[model samples]
Target chain A: AQSVTQPDIHITVSEGASLELRCNYSYGATPYLFWYVQSPGQGLQLLLKYFSGDTLVQGIKGFEAEFKRSQSSFNLRKPSVHWSDAAEYFCALTYLCYNNNDMRFGAGTRLTVKP
Target chain B: EAGVAQSPRYKIIEKRQSVAFWCNPISGHATLYWYQQILGQGPKLLIQFQNNGVVDDSQLPKDRFSAERLKGVDSTLKIQPAKLEDSAVYLCASSFGTDTQYFGPGTRLTVL
Candidate 1:
């Protein structure tokens, strides 16, 4: 079965510090990976996605993710963290089941930007 | 363009009671989905519909849970005799073909 893993449950970083969130996925074939952010009391917003082609994909809100096929990882990175950047991050992969595609999400990682 | 819309942003109901959530997908989106998200966890898909037909619902608890996307636009999910474990956020999303899905502000259900 296809699955996604987010090793970090919660992370605290100083404002303006660099940030990186780890994600690993298990799948047999090439997978469509995605990153989503959810703010408190709000719906989830797409950050980035990797379908094919270049390994690195840039997304909204100054977020970027690199899909490392060898490591089976798609980690998200931000050059500098801001107070507004704190939120829950989720890594997901498109999976095929019962002849239809559905998304499987990892346990989310909550980010705290300490000012 | 308008994003996905959901009603009853928050609801508190007693166990064994019935509750319902409504969702209106983005105009022209052919695919609609409903997901359940527990606190501190990621969203899990419960049901999916392609147009007016059911595409996938392998994870939905069929005994007391039911959903329908009639006419392929708006949808409703209902739970009868809700359980305590059903306390979570219910999210609705929609997509155009295989494109990125747009989510609505979820309905937070608390079963006491």
Candidate 2:
């Protein structure tokens, strides 16, 4: 079974500070990885995805994720954190098998921005 | 382009009652998905539809839960004799053939 693990349940960082959220996956083959952000009372929005090619992938809202095959990790990073960036972050994996896509998400990490 | 749309952002019902949720996916999206998201947990896929046909429903509880995607555009999920454990946010998402899925604002269901 393919699964994603977000080790951080909650993270607090000062405004303008750098941020990194750890994610690890258990899968035998290369998997499609994604990062999604969910704000309170709103639907989740896609931040970035890594299908293939370059390991470092850029996404919306000044977010980026690096997929490391060796570590089986796809960590999300941002150069500077903002108050608006405080939300629940989820790392997801999608496996394509027999023309069907099965997607799964991690438990999610809630980020808090401190002044 | 319009994003996915869902109705009745919130619903409150007593246990053993029944409830239904509606979803309208983006135009031209062939794949539709329904997910259940309990508080403090990630969303779990309950069912998947490919152009009005059931593609994957292994996770869906067939006894009291049912869903349909008619015309391959709009879809509905219903739960009968809702249990306390069924209280969760129901999310609907759609994607173009094997593409990234776009989600709609979920419908929060509370079983008293």
DockQ of 2: 0.83
Runs off by more than 4 Å, candidate 1? A96-99
Task: Estimate the lDDT of model 1.
Answer: 0.94
Which digits, one per residue and each the tens of the lDDT, describe model 1 over residues A1-115? 8999999999999999999999999999889999999999999999999999999999999999999999999999999999999999999999555536699999999999998
Clashing pairs in 2: none
| CA error at residue B18 for candidate 1, angstroms | 0.7
What candidate 2 gets wrong by more than 4 Å, as runs, is: none
Q: Each candidate's iRMS in angstroms?
A: 1.5, 0.8
TM-score per candidate: 0.98, 0.99
Q: What is every candidate's C-alpha DockQ against the true complex, given to 2 decimals?
A: 0.74, 0.83
Best by lDDT: 2
